[model samples]
Target: MNTQPLDDAGGPTAGELGEHAVIEAIVAAAPSSSNGDDAAVLTHAAPNSQVVATTDMLVEGRHFRRDWSTPEEVGKKAIVQNFADIEAMGARAVAALLAVSVPAETPVSFFERLAAGIESRVAEYSAELVGGDVVSGDQLVISVTAIGSLGGNLPSLRLDRARVGQRVVAHGKIGWSAAGMALLERFGRENVPEDLTEVVAAHCAPYLTPGRGVVARATGATSMTDSSDGLVVDLTTIAARSGVSVDLFAEAIAPGPELVRAGEVLGVDPWQWVLTGGEDHTLVATTANDVPSGFREIGRVGKQSGDPAVTVDGAAPHYHGGWVSF
Candidate 1:
């Protein structure tokens, strides 16, 4: 493998540098044996820890757009989403392998910036960058597989553990990302209101706080999930899996000013976004005991009595659940 050659501006196009060069650059910061290897070797930090793995893919037009998302933003979003999956299981992210398929004309600088973003986010959790493959494709496709470690003493949070009489609590903002997407779709990036800047950024690059799942586990949470697929959808999954129903209190979930402003601009009910928005990836857990600090009680669990698995104040949600790839 060769290092990417720099242009006059110290940035090179992948077309100019070739495949081997770009691969070498991406693995430069990787902690594993990325160079000159068919596969990277991994060793558990603790003998008793169990490994948890998850994979996600992002396509150019389906998941993101170049005009709206920078290379760094794309990188961070990819890593965070996969990492959130690990955290949702009550584990600590330990390593990641990234694979990318891009057109030959893609710029080497794009990969460089993307690797930097991945490296920075991985470092935030003291995780390693492992090895992955590079391939040629018609358009950009990025896939990330994240590995996590669960301490032998801690129990993994699962969807089927939810039971009646448990409280449904969530930490972090909900519906912000969907609201941001609404803004971007209704009005172009240039026309987005200044008040909605935070939500817009949340959509482009939402922050994932590590260890919140562990906190839920410590607080005796019986069931947990990441709200990546919208609150109603994820909650419905838990409800169906556990044979329990979740009733969300609308009064408990007061819409923020940003969502309100977004609803006003879009001429739609803000509560719809709150219930059905996806990509927020916030931590939602059902606990029989008090919720841990930093999490608020949103609703309660009960025996399933009817067809609808998740409801808002005893009523079905007005809108459908979050993003669907197909």
Candidate 2:
């Protein structure tokens, strides 16, 4: 009953282990804590004193379209996503461990720019790129794992306490990037504006500076999660985990002119891109007190015994749903 799961040294990839089985193995091996999850649990019963860790990945073609994105964009996207995960837990990502696989003929400047991009993101987030591995592969892929620390506050979870009617606000522009994607897809790169094109750049190059995560904690948030998957997915995660509900207004999702422009160019409904697009990497959190400036109120959370649904102007969120790997 005490057989330690051997670490994968050279053969049999780590993912070959069943996810649930891997989780159980990790929990079994970890220095015990009451919190059954991997993010982090208190070491001593004092609470608010501990270390935290999270790992996340960004796959090629799925997370980014190489035809459209640059190497630096790829690097920044990889780092920021993991950092956002640490942020969602109400912690600061102090360091990054990155792994990148690129083709043999890839340019040397490509790697320098990629490293520069990582350094830029680290500098942006006040995080350091501590270590990583580089290998040759058929396609470009980048994965980053971040270790963070709780600086005095209790680690925030998507599952946590909240009063009914707490305000849910996110710190970043909700749908601009998705609009940018639509613009590029519909207008073939030349038609989009420099302003909106920057949004496209942001979609590729996510900007989650170190201090933004603290802003989530400072706002009296009861629960928090990053918008890596999408706005509704993570909002729904917090709601489901905390047994609450949220009301989101589309108009309040930030006045995205790029959305309008993209919709116009493609003859597609702009709301679909706004409501369901993925990879914005914003922080959707619940707060009881006043929402800070630049933080837009998109929804509210309350007790509801059903699907962790989001309401659009008091109705459920509806769209075809966005990007799926499987």
What do the candidate models score in CA lDDT, each in turn? 0.82, 0.65
Worst 10 residues of 2 by lDDT: 1-10
TM-score of each: 0.92, 0.79
Residue 8 in candidate 2, Cα distance off native in Å: 36
Distance from true position, residue 91, model 2, in Å?
1.1
Q: Model 1: per-residue lDDT, tens digit, 110-190?
A: 787678778888888888778888888888899999999888676799999999999999988899988888887776565
Candidate 2, residue 262: lDDT: 59
What's model 2's lDDT at 165? 91
Model 1 vs. true fold: TM: 0.92
RMSD of 1: 4.6
On TM-score, the leading prediction is: 1
Q: What is every candidate's alpha-carbon RMSD to the true fold?
A: 4.6, 11.1
